[model samples]
Target chain A: MATKDILSPLPGTFYRKPSPDAAPYKNEGDVVKKGDVIGLIEVMKSFHEVQSDADGTIASFVAENEEPVMAGQPLITLNI
Target chain B: MTRKVNTLFIANRGEIAVRIIRAAKELRLKTVQAHSVADTESLAVKLADVAVNIGSPAASKSYLNVEAVVAAAVASGADAVHPGYGFLAENARFAEAVEAAGLIFVGPTPHQIRMMGDKVSALEAAIAAGVPTVPGSRGRVETPEDAAKVVELTGFPVMIKASAGGGGRGIRVANSRDEFDRLMPQASAEALAAFGDGGLYIEKFVASARHVEVQVLGDGYDVVHFFERECSLQRRRQKVWEEAPAAMLPEDVRARLCQSAVNLAKAVNYRGAGTIEYLYDETTRDFYFLEMNTRIQVEHPVTEMITGFDLVREMIRIAMGERLRMRQSDIVMRGHAIECRINAEDPAKGFMPAPGTIESLTIPGGAGVRFDTLLYQGYTVPPFYDSLLGKLIVWDENRDAALDRMQRALKELTIGGLKTTKPLHLALAADPDVRAARFDTQFLEAWLEHRAAMLEDH
Candidate 1:
């Protein structure tokens, strides 16, 4: 089976950390389980935690911190 | 508390802003309009006492920019802001920001807006207030496991909705466990895209239900319902045709329905005009609370016509902290009213948006007929905003008379240089089921498709 990249399900500003001073939830080369908190997407004062649906090692992070991401746009690549 | 709305700043564009400008003008209040670069030459800007350029065509830079709107209000020296329908109308933070700026947010309080903005929380409040809600999850599920748990408890064939979602986006139906599993990701993705909150909430889907809503006005203490409207005819969760006094409801049940709306509004200490929406199943004669819109709805005109009230003017009065001038007992339903949303869209071409300059325009005029529009000859319908060009409302003594008036008014309306859904609306008015009010929410879409197929057959 081919490894798939996790994409943003909505359009918003993506934040890697919960807060500016907090540690990132997941980093490069980190092993992640299904439903693991990947990052938060802020839309109109609401923060939504974007979760990973596949178990894998992080191949790459496609979105930058505080960057705007579109729906179905790749957020992070996962190596199964 | 005494409030003075000397100057009003409208924080939206298109026909709604124009409508607000007219109402403000009638009230002798100076109107200040903020427009994006695209809407600079629109009718609203032309009619306003003064105009300010905010940003580019992208809504984020103009309408959705709370700071920009507040800055415009401050710069224009306006004492109040009127968020016309969409954008920041129901946004609690925006309301708070407006209040923080020491400007009157001409709607409900931030607390009220926040309480009603969340669907799950709003349902809980409705239940607590003795408002009947549909059989579904009592609260929102945070995880897929939680959603599965709720599904197992409530059984299958449930709907997954976004807590922050509105306008029919971020909703998916699943009939089986496999379907639920497959649809969860897509729905979550959609919810995230639409509302920025992929927080999915599950509810039992009520099929073949009539979309009815009660219009209510409140003064932060007393609340009164102004009867109900049947908005069963819809396309993609947006109301297309609305009629006052639902045709199929029993008299006692209708009274109870309207009263329930009043109770909920009072429970929240809601101010200004709001709508209490419900899903009514005709077969079972059961109704359930759907949601409360804490702003003036597009279909307010129909209710106003039937009840002989100026809802917009009431909103302005309510915003000024004036007590509701009329009581529930004083209100009397006089006539049947119907409104058809006239949009710049071609129904024959999959309802494609047809935006262009109006080469010719002739609006119908007569007693018992009203057209709330901003379109004029030589005016261009912009593609940036919603396709709705105007609303055609007609009132008569009875449903049949109202239907005849609407049909006649629609036939008389003329707008060239762009296609519209008028042809489709005319055809629907002629349908037997529609005339009898036997149609449900899905009637319009299916009927349009059926018409398309018949056209193909011909």
Candidate 2:
């Protein structure tokens, strides 16, 4: 097994769901594909999607939802 | 009889917070800065007589948290709360909360805030006050049949607006009868989904209009006008530049427009500093009341420059239960003043907000020029708030001179390690149409599109 970490590209509040009422884009033990949105980073009142760069499966999110995140901080870990 | 405000609490952040602190200090009132965790080192916090961390960085947990803000104000022993421009400035419930907690809300009464805060009610009040309003439905158009009736009177092009919508949101314009029928239902559904209100209103769509607003101050008994501001230059319905004593407004029309604003404020027995916004049709030379902001606005400094009055100080005094201090004739508009909103966004890249540490800062200064900012060397602008880094305001004897001064000041401002909208303002200052004072509400977005295409060719 190979492990990799997805890093946040911006410094802001990270959200796992598209909106407050919506389900999270990804969860632990969920399979993900490249270019799949896993979270959103809200910066300066604007939202940007954080996409997975590689195919992975069944890992864990390092950064919690609605928490402040910094650029280059690890947001999720994946097993390939 | 007036209750003096010995301590003032600022329940907002950014340049406005700093602006309030300065005004309070000038009045010899203690300033307590209520800030989020992310703004611990903000210039406002640094400059205040005291500081309190209300909650986390997200505004929902701090600035907009009515309970938290009110508790913080009480705990800080602050007698009055200034909500600034955003956050809870217009939230009537928040104003009520502050007052219920034995503290003064530095704005109008909650009833007045609620009245002006609603689109439908605000329009009704405008009509009742004898202020000219856009020809449309009397109140919320409940159904398509009712909307059709309004369109009959409003003509071909009409606007379908959500009574709960604001900041240019939840609006659909129909240019023809067919378009109106098709869009009316969709707009209603969207408004319900967005604002939980299916209520809608109709208004005559002014094809070529300018965004002119009159500044008024009231003490719950009397109201006075500070002339008008032209904020037609906007991007995404957000004002980018503002000028006081709207350029080329016929003196007679200006007088009528200003008096109308005072009429509305008196109707509400309005307190504190407020702005009565209007849509002015330059071709017809007719003006209609748009809405009233029951709080101090972002472009207030331009009015201050043209008329040497400290609006912030006046609002604080009004909050302390003081009566109207100045008469209508005492306030005079002397010169042309312009204000450019400097945001921490990249102008070339669709205004992508860039939040970073300020490595160096070169502030513009001289006679009749002021840069109101919450920035300092080594300050890290948090990515949590609006992109407004500061406002660069300039004043001169005439419009032409003010424009020249704005160009010079924009050139002198420099911020390191951050992308800003400085380039955008520079281009606007150089543009011939802008210099000639020829633009309407829809001008800047179209101008931005044209500028983007030009940039792509290069």
Candidate 3:
């Protein structure tokens, strides 16, 4: 299996859940198709969605939920 | 309200953080820096006695998080919090939060901030205190017709300003009836986008005015002014170079300007450090109250250099409820001081921000030169905040000497990686008008245009 890393496009707080009351968009080991949002990056009080580019199963999340991330930092590792 | 502040928590970052930490160290106080995770390796964190991670790097969850900052102060056993120039520095809610957590907020009270934060209210307050203000709309003007009424009364060439705005974000000048009609809606749109307030007000536009500000320190009732600083050399209304003991202000005019500032401070029963900005029409020798900044300003170092007083330290003392130690008569401006705001932005290519790592750094030193900065060799300039990399300030026996030192200092100072306004500062230092002190608030835009045109011809 080939592992691909999903990198953040912006530097800010990484969020896995869509909202506080909702569950995370994806969990480790969950199968995600192309265009599926894996996490969100919050910068300057705005949220930007980080979507997967290829269909794969999530191997692991490199950045923890609510963790601060830099541009191009790995957010999730996917097994393609 | 005098409370002992042993452990001080710094609730901001960048040069101001470094500034506060140094002041606290001098005062023999333990310091804690509440930083975002991204700024863990910042210079301020390195110098602080303790560092606490408040939240993620996003300012909303970290520096601007009133609750997180208050919690960090209490959790770190900090007795006081210094909200530096930006972030939550002017936030009244943050001040209340710090006080609610039983810690001293090192600035003005929440009420004073609330009163002055809104431009319309500040104008009304200034008038109540007998401070001279530009004639303008008595209230918020939303429509062009209402703005026309104000423009008609104030006469031709009036300024439309945002009711809730600062830092020169929401301002437009109209010279004629057609211009006024076109600018009224344009100014309102910018005001709404910048301040979340579409409300506008028109004021009599005093042409070719100098931007001068007076530094004032107050403890409830007693207030004192630290002379004035001429900040007329600006670009897009951004102050680039500032000098103190305003050049060529008549003796009586200086007295009246300083006195009016004191009167305003007394009117507000202001506390801590503040600056009263004025637009001086050099041609007429008349000055109008522009606005009052409730927090310690970025350009405070110029005033300090001339007055020989540590404004930040004095602010901390004032927050501790101590009476102002100096009287108006006791304070006298000495010599001359000028400050250059060194930003990590290029003058050409439309002043684009160039954030990167500094591979090498050279800071100028010697008598009469001071550099206040957080830049260290190999340190990365983060893109999340202000472009101000540092401020190079110099003091001398007179303006010419100070200008000469600044030019030399500018030549000696270097940051290896980023494109800075250094080149522009050098050119302005040698510009004929700048050297002769012949400029106003409207000077820089035209200067830059002329400089660019000259460059093209070459």
Candidate 4:
């Protein structure tokens, strides 16, 4: 088994849920496919969705929900 | 007389924080700049007499955190807290908390904030003050059938809005009877899911209306108007460009429009700086009250430039219990002024946020041109907040000259290392329609669409 990391493409506040009270797009151990949204990055008051580039199961979330992250920082680790 | 404020704590950031610090210093008030972990190197912090680290970089943990902000203000021994424009500026609970902690909240009372913050009550207050409001349901329309009856009189194209919504959220525009019925339930469900309150209201959508607002100052007893500013040039409901003394506003209409704002302010016994927004229909020469902003607006500089008044200073003085020294007659409008909001965005690529370090900065200057910004050489614009880098304001004796001055100023301005809305402003300054003052609230989106299409063809 091998693990791959999904890095943030932009610097901003990362949100696991689409909105404040909504359920997160994916949880740890959940299987995800390419193009599936894993989280959202809110920059300068605008939101950008973070899609998984490779199909895998989410091994762990490297960036906590509602935490500030920089561009190129690891957001989640996937077991491919 | 109320106790004088000697120390002012700015519980906000960006250019507005710097703007407040300058006003506080002029008033001889010691300034305390509140910053998040990320904004330690910001220009506001650099200029303030003292700086207080409130919390982390996220706004929710810092600027918008009411408890953290109040505690910091109290600990800093600040006599007054200035919530500049956004964040906790209009939050009634925040105002109450600041006052409870024995610090003056440099704006309206908590009651006024809460009243104007609510859509239905604010409309009721406007009607009570004899202000002309858009023709719609008197209050909340709880049922679709009730909405139908109201729309019969006002006719097609009505807006269904959530009572607790702001920032253009929880809104739906229904064009006809069928559309109204179709959207009502869906809109209600969306509002409920989003805001936790399903309460909804309706207003007749004013197509092709210009966004004009009157700037007002009050001392809890006496109120005065600084005339009007036309901000019809908006993108996605956010004002992009603003000008004072709305273009082509007939003298009689201007008089009425300004008077209506004063009436509303006086009715609420409003204190400090506020803006009364209106939707003006050029075709009928009728202006309807949109809502009231209980704090200073981002576009306040345009009004200040035309009137030759320091609005921020006056607001600070008013907060210290000083009476408005100047009367309405003394606040004469001398010239036309324009403001273009320069944002850290790529206008060509759908105004996408482009946050990067300012490798270099060349601020435009030369008489009548003012650039209020937080950008400095080597400063990195954080992605945690708004994209607004600064506002480029220009004033001249007349509208034509002001437009020309704006063009000159935009050309002189330069900010290296990131794409900005500067190009958009440059294009707008040269536009024939913009120069002719032929536009409405909906004009910019259409113009941008056409411009994009033209770019594609080329």
lDDT winner among the candidates?
Answer: 4
Candidate 4 chain B — worst ten consecutive residues by lDDT sum?
A: B449-458
DockQ-best of 1 and 4: 4
**Predictions in order: lDDT:** 0.86, 0.92, 0.87, 0.93
**Per-residue lDDT of B288-387 in model 3, one digit per residue for the tens?**
9989999989999999999899999988888877899888888888999999999877677567666678999999999999999989998987656667
lDDT of 2 at B5: 81
Tens-place lDDT per residue, model 2, B15-85, is 99999999999999999999999999999999999999999999999999999999999999999999999
For residues B8-79, could you state the per-residue lDDT of candidate 1 as single tens digits?
999988778888898888999999999988788888999999999998665777899988888888889999
Task: Pick the TM-score winner.
Answer: 2
lDDT of 2: 0.92
Q: Compute the lDDT of residue B36 as modeled in candidate 2.
A: 96
Give stretches of model 3 more than 4 Å off: A1-80, B140-155, B159-202, B452-458
Docking quality level of the chain pair in candidate 1: incorrect
Task: Please tell me which model should have the higher DockQ, number 2 or number 4.
Answer: 2
lDDT of 2 by residue, A1-80 (tens): 99889999999999999999999898899999999999999999999999999999949899999999989999999998
Cα TM-score per model? 0.77, 0.93, 0.80, 0.91
Model 4 residue B127 CA deviation (Å) reads 0.8
| Segments of candidate 1 deviating more than 4 angstroms | A1-80, B139-205, B453-458
* lDDT by residue (tens digit), candidate 4, B1-458: 66778899999999999999999999998999999998999999999999999999989899999999999999999999999998999999999999999999999999999999998899999999999989888678887778888899788789999987988899899998889888999988988999998988898888789999999999999999999999999998999999998987999999999999999999999999999999998988999999999999999999999888999999999998999999988999988999999999888788888899999888999989999999999999999999999999999999999999999999889899988888888888999999999999999999998675232101
Higher-DockQ candidate among 1 and 2? 2
